[model samples]
Target: MNARLLILLPASLITAPALAQGGDSPLDPLFTCRDIADDGARLACLDAAVDALRSETESGEVVAVDREQIEAAEEATYGLTIPQFRLPGLSLPGGGEDAELAELESASASPQRVIVRDTNGQIESIEGLAVAEISENRSGDTIVRLANGQVWRQTDDTYVQLTRSRADTDYTATISNGALGSHFMRLDNGGRRFRVERVE
Candidate 1:
């Protein structure tokens, strides 16, 4: 994994909850490193407490805000931030290759396909497509293309055939099942449309 990805790993491992805290809330638990009779015992106790709290929060048995408060209490007592617990080797299932393959297969099987014709002389396919760009005509109909290569005249959510672009040329297209309840594009590009069900 990239070093930058490591930065997000810690944040993702630890949940951050927005909880209301004021004088009215109950006092937080404190773990004192100095309280132990010996140096080794004190360090071990502190480590154990922090690990236990982190595990509970990550498992959703305890919320993140409560954990934060606990850490705050420990910090106040010890004047040091406890080492946060993280699951080792956490990763997305199947990685990017599997995800791309799934997307292509879904698009190929979709009923609605959007085709694209680029200036180049190569052809590409897009499946599981959604609206990327819209150029308006005088008739108020929109020329919509997908991440895949299916193009159609869309009046509203429904699309109708206007003109088909030649496939021998370089272009990109996309198709989508639109089977998901809600519609959202990919976070990175905001163009690749994937159903929540398909993605999950």
Candidate 2:
């Protein structure tokens, strides 16, 4: 284990800057130790790399996020336009002028409720979201709060009524990306569809 760790130093030193600038990954150094030929040198390298990584993490220069955290972030930011930028220690798949970091496929237990992304890796649709609460604004616009804490507001004048007495599970919806950056929410119970914009 020590030898394997030592091999990491030179590779990490060589790769860390490229990773920082090119949107690769600092975590690559953790995997580079296997290439070292000398045992003592490999152990030293790994030790140095590990120390650097620990320091970077403690100083907030690097952040570690698991799959669930990333998915939660994706869900929270869905239906919104996020400007492209690189974050340290968060390298995403794909490359090119128009390529985007592909989101990890959702591991939600609900078989039918999964986040779907478009060709550009933008969220295209989310299915089977339970309605947690519903209300109306002073302007008579309907406001819906989903179980995941997302808030959506009705944008059109269409009059539609949802049964308030039904269980929250009975008020499921599927929201999809609509034409020209618009969004539409379709209720599974009544098949009622309406234009909506995220309010929170």
Candidate with maximal TM-score: 2
Question: TM-scores for all candidates?
Answer: 0.24, 0.61
Tell me the whole-model lDDT of each prediction, alpha carbons only. Answer: 0.34, 0.61
- For model 2 the local lDDT of residue 92 reads 29
lDDT of 2 by residue, 1-200 (tens): 23221211212222223322335466677568757898988898899889989887666456565434334445555665442222223442221121122221222323467678777555789988767777899999988777665679999987756766777556777899889878998877675689999876
Clashes of each: 26, 8
Worst 10 residues of 1 by lDDT: 18-27
Residue 48's lDDT within candidate 2 is: 84
| Candidate 1 Cα deviation (angstroms), residue 176 | 21
Q: Total backbone clashes of model 1? A: 26
Candidate 2, residue 196: lDDT: 96
Of candidate 2, the 10-residue stretch with the lowest lDDT total is 95-104
Q: Which lDDT value does model 2 have at 98?
A: 16
Assess the local accuracy of residue 81 in candidate 1 as a C-alpha lDDT between 0 and 100: 19
lDDT of 1 at 144: 49
